[model samples]
Target: MDPALSLDSRVATLSLAGMALAWSVGLTILSIAATGAWEPRVWAVALLATATIVVARETAPLRAPFTAQAHLVVHVLACTAYLLYTNGSEGSAASRWLPWIPIALSLLIVAMCRYRPPREILGAGLLSTSAIALATMPLVAAPMPLHGAPGGALVLTAVLPVMTASVAAACYSRILVANSERWKAQAGYSSAALEPALLSDIERVMYRERVNALSGEAFPFLRRVLDADSISAADRDTARDIAARIRSAMVHEVDRTWLQAAVDSGPTGVHAPVVDDPDACAPMMSGTQRAALRTLISSLGASPRLDRFTISIRATDGTCRGEVWARFRAPYRPPRRRRNADLAVLRVAFSEVTVSTPADQLIVRFSFDHA
Candidate 1:
């Protein structure tokens, strides 16, 4: 696994464990005080239940598809079971309302899970109103208890656990957000470092095309002479076979007249226009150069957002300097040279390649030196 993903998993697990610990400890303390029996027997039993829950929570991390929702359900059930066993409707003020405290904490967990929902504000308002209504029910429905006395202390103890649990839930959410941002930043940096390598590879393919056009032998033994140390066997075979044939076939037929035939001609299968063009402008283009631009434009078709594309070459002045232009629509990235075989070919035909964007328009202009 990637280091970033591993770190995020660990942070998420710790956050869930923290919430579980806060809830378990709060309930344990409240239960001991309300019953007024540090009697070794009952106190030990309550502590044991808290320990069991804390340990169980660690094994069930929050990422098992439905695990988070299931864990919440288990936590809610544990709270209900603990309250019912320790202080069922004994009509005792301390134990009678203990169940509601955990109920409020469970609701806190649910609200945390839906932090960015559109109804979060409304849901929270409703929850706060519900907790107030539920907590005050005992006082309103029954006789008043004396203030600043044992009964008042018991009431405060029941509410304190719910309040502390809310704070812990909020803290857990902030930590999760921070960790997510950290992972995204790391991934972005790694992607940027590979861009230069891709550009260099494109340059290598363009030169290979020129070498192939000059050799009658379909495969060049030139790979060993150029970079025997770093070149792989598979790449050497492809380079030699493809470049030698290209050189032998294209060297004699390529010239100014041959290029003009392509410009005046319509749809020779060598150029696929992104937009319909009756008179293609790339008349002075060499066969390898035309092949290159065609490759670049065809690859753009794979990108769903790239609606239309065009590359036209025009000669200017007495010297047949070629200009290639292309436009790609929004929500698409420029074709990478190494990946788009066509652009790699066209690039060798020109001395310089310039890309520009003004407003929503994307332009790629290729400049050929005087020839």
Candidate 2:
């Protein structure tokens, strides 16, 4: 799976866990403070325990599927159980509206649709709507008096939010999908303007290094050959051989492309080998992407905690995929602010970027088109 998608799943899982924790805590406090039947309080405690267990299991270090269906099932059941217990137990207007709490909670599920597939999102919406409808059936049949309002009206009031929230979720999911496509399109168009500047900067740096190399090695060798006045045939041949070798070296140095030079000069402890197969040639990344990759490499090299790092890139079918693996000398948690800043830049440059921390290892995987 794409690393970006995995990160998104983790984020969604954590968010759901946090929500469940908050809901459980709040429910427990409310049960303690409010004068309610012992049965409802017991049920709330049981539900809270279940929620805690689910969260612990889901948020474990090991990767596991965090399904939208599971989320809807747990929360909907908890909310329904609470509503069933609370309804008609109190005469306050608030008590009559207790059924709406579950619908409101559904919004959290809706918000998470960003991380889910369209079909999953649609399924969750339908499940939530059905759960809300089924949970409120008792109230609809019993016709609970709320300031003399009809039971149907009261049911509609609760149902409307669920319907509205479902529509909103669909719209939000569509927007997220559209924005992702738009960004890729923008990156493709913008790459043309950006590539030259990146290439020029890289060339300038390489040129300076080449100049230094010529002054230190090639020029001195040639000067020695020129200074020798009395030279035998053997000596002249040796000089000619040295001159040819020097010329060849200079030509090779000059012929090295900007990308090759940059890759060769990458920070210590990072290895990017040249893959000879045509299918394995690195894709032509946009200037922005190259810049982002350079920045990320620099940041990783500068980190005192990182002991070793390796990155590999390969291209196939017009797409370039890269993987970065870093090992820490000790357990290290990267500074969130700096890491996020780098990732944000990378996310803009690449179509997808994923970062994973497992035990003492950090893995970053990303892919982008040739553009």
Candidate 3:
């Protein structure tokens, strides 16, 4: 796992800054004891500074982006310089044992994995590895043991970390992309899954409306009856009339489907979605498909220019075809990108789906199987 992810972008942690400083000091000490040379130590300073800068910049949101080629080039040069310094280490295991430059470069690449996509990381890693190897292959001294291979093969050992990091970044990046796309796809369905609450809310409103109707139409008359000083022919006639009207209303409301209730239960009194499913195809659709429609409709509602939308479902042969067509006020309409995504979701949910816009209108036609 990449530990760099844990670092906050707002502030660079003291521990990392301290680690970079210690690295520079350690490499400087090794150069003195091993080669007594100033060249390697100088290169160590450059590499340490470059690596620290990369890490710091990546963590800082307002700083230079990780994709900047300039940073990559500086890092490569520093790595190459360190490789040359390693060559000056004679009669000692300092270069062979520490190999700090390549190690640091590899670690930097790993840290970068948290900041950018895999392809960019792969490119950066590979470029750094190849550049350093090319720069140092001719300048640096080759180890004595080739085992029949060319002397230049030692360059590979110095850069192997970079190569590994490149491949790892590529694989890691692909996973990140795949996961992101999946998240975008599933987000709609998850939001739509809240349809139960919407339906429950609609039911609550319907119950309240029913109660209000009874209170308004019959309750007042019943109160008058309870408080009557004496019964009369007119009272009997009024009670019979109220009884007939309430019975008629109850029967009518009972026969209306839940789909109709949902359709007419728009948030706004005007410009509500119009339904045209004479065959009542909504109740027959799979819950998943129905949820998708609900999500699509809810998303469309966000657009202000939407005058009115109609959900028309018809039975044909053995299948139920549906179309959700919405007309705008005029030239203004929803953006193509957002509309495409909404339609894409319906396309996935339905067996067949098509979308079209014929001047001031957005239409999505689809078909689905029964539950």
Identify the candidate with maximal lDDT: 3
- Tens-digit lDDT string for candidate 1 (1-371): 11122323444444554565565557546756776544432443354345334433423222112233343443444444434433323334334344433443444343333232223323433444345445444543444332323555544555455455555554554555577678878877886897789878867965676665445343344544475667677866877776666655565345334334334344433343433222334554565466655555555444444544454454456443333343456645554432323433344445565555554445656665333
RMSD of 2: 7.7
What lDDT does each candidate get?
0.45, 0.61, 0.65
| Per-residue lDDT of 203 in model 1 | 75
lDDT-best of 1 and 3 = 3
- What is the C-alpha lDDT profile of model 3 across 1-371, one tens digit per residue? 12222234223333444465567667777657655677756766666766666566544422223344644654665566566665554422233334466666665555555556777778777777877677555434444432333445557776787789668867866786777678868986886898899899979988997888789858888888789888789988988988898788888777655556665665674455777878767788776577668777777776778888888889887789988888888877656556543554465467766777788888888887655
Ranking of all candidate structures by their lDDT, best first: 3, 2, 1
Global fold similarity of model 3 (TM-score): 0.44
Candidate 3 scores a C-alpha RMSD against the true structure in Å of 14.3
Worst 10 residues of 1 by lDDT: 58-67
- Compose the digit string of candidate 2's lDDT tens values, residues 1-371: 11233444555655655665566556555644665555765665466456545544533323223445455555655565556554424443444244425543554555355554555566656665666666566655554454556667766766666667667767766777777889989988898789999899989987887677567756776687689776577766866876787678779776655556676777776644342323433436777777877777777777777777776777867777888777777767655445654665676567667778887777878898765
How high is each candidate's TM-score? Answer: 0.34, 0.53, 0.44
Any runs in candidate 2 off by more than 4 Å, and if so which?
1-97, 110-123, 142-151, 169-184, 196-296, 304-371
